[model samples]
Target: MPSPFILSGCSGGGKSSVLDELKDRGFTVVPEAGRRVVADALQTNSNALPWIDPLAFCRACCDLHMQDLAKLPNQERRVFLDRSLIDLFAYLEMKRISVPADLGAALRAVSYAKTVFLTPPWQQIFVNDQERKASFKEAALEYEHLLSSYRSLGYQVTLLPKTSVADRTDMLLNELDQMDA
Candidate 1:
C-alpha cells in the first residue's frame, strides 16, 4: 500500500487550498472527511454534527476516511490527504471526548508517510463557514493538538510556510523531489 501524505492543521488554515494546488499539479488528493460528513448531515437534517452529536459525526468521518483509503491505488507512490485518521483523535482530545477503543485500533493499524505537511494557524486566512464553526481561538487550540498528536505518533511534522498557495505548492513539490532524490 502506498502511504499517504497528510496535510493537517486547524480548520481554515489553507489545507484545502494547498490540496487544490496539489490536485492542479496532477497529484492524487483525498478530500477531508469532516466537511463531507457535515454536508451529509445538513442535507439529511440529522443530528450528526460536530456540535450537536460529535461522537456520531466523528464515527461517520472515520468510516468515510477508511473508504477513501481503501480506494487509493496501491501503485501510486504518493498521494496527498487533506486530513488523516489521526486528526480524529485530536478532535476527541480537543472536545474532551474519550477515544473509542475501536477507533484507536483502527488508527494504529493504518500508516502514513513520516513527513506530514502541517499548516499553522494563520489569522489572515482563517474563516468560519457553516460547516467549519470553530472559532479562531478554537482553531488555534486544534492546531496545537494536531501538532502534538502527529508528534506522539512519531511522524516528522513539516510546517508549511505561511505564504501564497502557489508558493506552498512549490515548496511541497521541491520537498517531495528532494525526498525522491
Candidate 2:
C-alpha cells in the first residue's frame, strides 16, 4: 500500500480547511486525532484532555490513529491525514516527557508519505477554540518542533504557502498530481 500524505502543523492553521476541501472533492481524508480525542473526552466529561493530561491525551490520540490506519482500505488511491503518530513523538519531546516504549515502537514502525504538508503559523488566523487552546506562539513552537521531528525521521516537510484556503487546496491537489506523474 502507498504511504498516506499527512497534513500536520501549527494549531489554528488552515490544515482543517484544506482537509475539508479535499474531503469535499471526494478524496479520502483522516481527521486530526487530537481533535477527535478532545471531542470524545468532552462527551464523557473526562479530564483526559491535552491541557489536563497531555500524556494521556497523546496515548488516546495514538490509539485512535492506529485504529484508523488499520481500518482505512485503499491500496492505490491517495490518502490524506491531518496528523499521525509522528505528532505524538513531537508532542512528547515538546513537553519534555519521555515517550513510552510502546509509543516509541509505533512511531518507528508507522510512516507516511515522504513528503508531508505543514500549515505554517499565521498570526492573523490563529485563534483559541474549545478544542484548540494553544496560543499562536505555542503553535509556532509546536510547528518548529514537528518540522524538525519529521525531517529527522526522513520525510520531506513541505510548508503550505500562506494563502487563501481555495488556493492552498488547489496547490495541494496540483502538487499531489505532479507527484503521481
Predicted model with the maximum lDDT: 1
In candidate 2, position 86 carries an lDDT of 88
Model 1: per-residue Cα lDDT over 1-71, one tens digit each = 66889999978899999999888878899999999999999999988899999889989999999999989
Give TM per candidate.
0.96, 0.95
Q: Could you give candidate 2's per-residue lDDT for residues 16-83 as a string of tens digits?
A: 99999998888899988899999999999988798899889998998999999988886687889989
Q: How many clashing residue pairs, candidate 2?
A: 0
Q: Per-residue lDDT for 161 in model 2?
A: 97
- Give the Å shift of residue 154 in candidate 1: 0.3
RMSD in angstroms between candidate 1 and the native structure over all alpha carbons: 1.0
Error of 1 at 105 (Å): 1.6
Which run of 10 residues does model 1 get worst, by summed lDDT? 69-78
